[model samples]
Every structure is written in C-alpha cells, then in structure tokens.
Target: MSFTDSTEAPIYAGLVEEQGDVPAEVRRVAEEVLREADRAIDFGTVGAASAR
Candidate 1:
C-alpha cells in the first residue's frame, strides 16, 4: 500500500532521521514497518468497517 498524502513522507523521513546511522538492512525493514503502520492508520481513520 502507498500513502495517500505527501505529508506522510516527511514525518516518516523524520522518524528515519532520528535513528542516526542504522544498518542498511535494518533501515529497510524499519521503513517497511512504518509503511504498514501508516496504511493501517489510514484505513482506520477513514472508518472502514470491520467484521470483528
């Protein structure tokens, strides 16, 4: 999934920047995690109903 707004990139970038110099692989994984979190938040914010 992708971000719906441009504002998210900078916030995510700031999160990455705060980590200092992390290993390339670790950084990649962290970014993937952040993206997933952003997707989940967006889905929740838009009020998508859930069966559970």
Candidate 2:
C-alpha cells in the first residue's frame, strides 16, 4: 500500500527524469507534495472504510 513499491517507483522516477532541469528546491517540494498526497490517499481510504 505504498507508492514506493517496485511498481510505482519507476513511474515516479520517470516523472522526475522527464522534468529534467527542475530546480533543486522545486524537486524537493515536489517530492514532499507527492508524499503528502500519498499519505492523504491512504488515510482517506481508511477513514472512508471505517465510516461504513
């Protein structure tokens, strides 16, 4: 249930690669945002199920 898994890791890496020349700060922020989004998705799904 993690975005860091084998399946998604390559896709994420590819995204970063495609965005070549991205600023260091921008890359850092992008990673942080993606991580937060992943966490939100995980928590939201769990919360929804628990509410059922």
Candidates' TM-scores?
0.37, 0.38
lDDT values of the candidates? 0.65, 0.71
Using lDDT as the measure, the top candidate is: 2
Q: For candidate 1, give the lDDT of residue 1.
A: 36
Cα deviation in Å at residue 29, candidate 1?
Answer: 0.2
Name the runs in model 2 displaced over 4 angstroms. 1-22, 43-52
Across 1-42, the per-residue lDDT of candidate 2 in tens digits comes to 644354768776566567653566688999999999997777
| Model 1 agreement with the true structure over 1-52: per-residue lDDT tens digits | 3232337676655655676435666879999999999977776645655643
